[model samples]
Target: MEMSLQSMQLQLQFFMHKADDLHSCLVNGQGHVERDALAAAVVSFLYTCQPYFNHLESTVRSTRPQHTSLALNIYTQLLDIYQQLCDKLEQLVLSCASYNLLCLEETEPNSVSHFCVGQCQLGQLKLTTFLYCKPTPYLSQVDTRLYKRMRWNVEKLQVGQKTDKDQGGESKEREAKTEYYFLCYEDIPNTHAETDWGRPGFSDGNVVRMWSIGQWVQVDPDPITETIDDWILCDVPQANYNKLLFLGIEEPSCCIATDYMQQLLLLWKSADSW
Candidate 1:
């Protein structure tokens, strides 16, 4: 049996209350640690509320009631709630991905694009998309400190293999944990690596410097070629370290939160519609 408008409105109202609670909680102390949980909750709310919007819109259309204005009022509130959830999701995702706080989402095209541009290192753009998601983090620009350890093992392993029978009852067993390094560029806030606002603003000097350094090859190297590089890196920085340590070296990659990626996708989709 089909439900009445009052029943559906009640359900939506209940969710609206929960959304308010979530908003308050996030505004209270949301961070990288609990961002994924918050995002998941938002998504759950959106999943439940979306069909209601569709149902209401359909009801308005099929019924063709004279009180369309009242229906529009409810519809507007539903859409606004959806948009707010999207914003919150984006915020959580960005924090998780940038800081490696462990938020989750999906692997959609738009997500891939946002994560690729934001998560992947600047010099590794030339690498294939398949290669970009590797656990190694940065592919092209690895720190020499890692190479030093790898080299030490390469030579030491040879030495150990050759002279194993040194003691009377025991062989020399060398055990070492393997590790890797990644490079991330951080943009100093007021520096040239910053993106300017639409009409009047300065551009990213760091990407320009990378372009000048023969690392980044822009598709369109026009007079504003530097601007193009900066544009691509609007979400990236010129120098930042990882969230943890690996054998005394900082961890090697920047990872965008899945929730944030979804938020950007939603925003991109919304803009596409406009």
Candidate 2:
């Protein structure tokens, strides 16, 4: 039996949401309550998705030329979602294993916890707190020489809105639309041809810069006079958004920006050059 593209997309969406929920549970430290059930759901979801992947691949290969592009696009989206699901599954499994190990250690008092002072101590997992810095003033007018070979651009758009639910009922209002500045850039490698240099294009092997909404804080307690002020770019988690809405991201969850921000913070905290 053949399934419609819409049906396949919907199915993928369902699976993506399931994976997201399971991942959230693990991250929130609630895995202990339903570790077995969560693991079982992940396994069942993987098995169910296998056939859809095969079918999508076959459809992309066998579809008519007129419909091939759409079919291929859907296939690509499904593949991306599947990859995220696999990543979530890996994390879930690791979390479960860690939980089991902790339980074992608790049950057996003879087991000695291996670690040194101030190194590798067991404690509650705490979520990192991020502060919103003020946006950069006249960002476009600023010189890009400090960024080296990289290029920058800013976009102001209404990514989403705020809704207020009153005591009477839900009051829908479009008057209060929050506009955000979406900062994006591409880091071009100097190894490229001189002719291709300064040209704005996203090609293979080029590192896509992070997207940021805000800029640097005006009053810096520890000001660095050496470095030029730049716009701050962050991801969904740092921005305090549930998901990536600005980029029209269809995925249920994204960690690229969050991961990038975390690494940048670590470098800034550890490096003295900043």
lDDT of each: 0.35, 0.37
Off by over 4 Å in 2: 1-3, 29-33, 64-274
User: Residue-wise lDDT of candidate 1 within 176-231, one digit each (tens)?
Assistant: 32222223232232343335453434554432211000022123334234576666
Which stretch of 10 consecutive residues in model 1 shows the poorest summed lDDT?
Answer: 147-156
Query: Which candidate's lDDT is highest?
Result: 2
**Stretches of model 1 off by over 4 angstroms after superposition:** 1-3, 66-274
RMSD to truth, every model:
21.2, 25.6
For 211-236, candidate 2 gives per-residue lDDT tens digits of 33233333222234423333232111
Instruction: Give the TM-scores of the predictions, in the order they appear.
Output: 0.27, 0.28
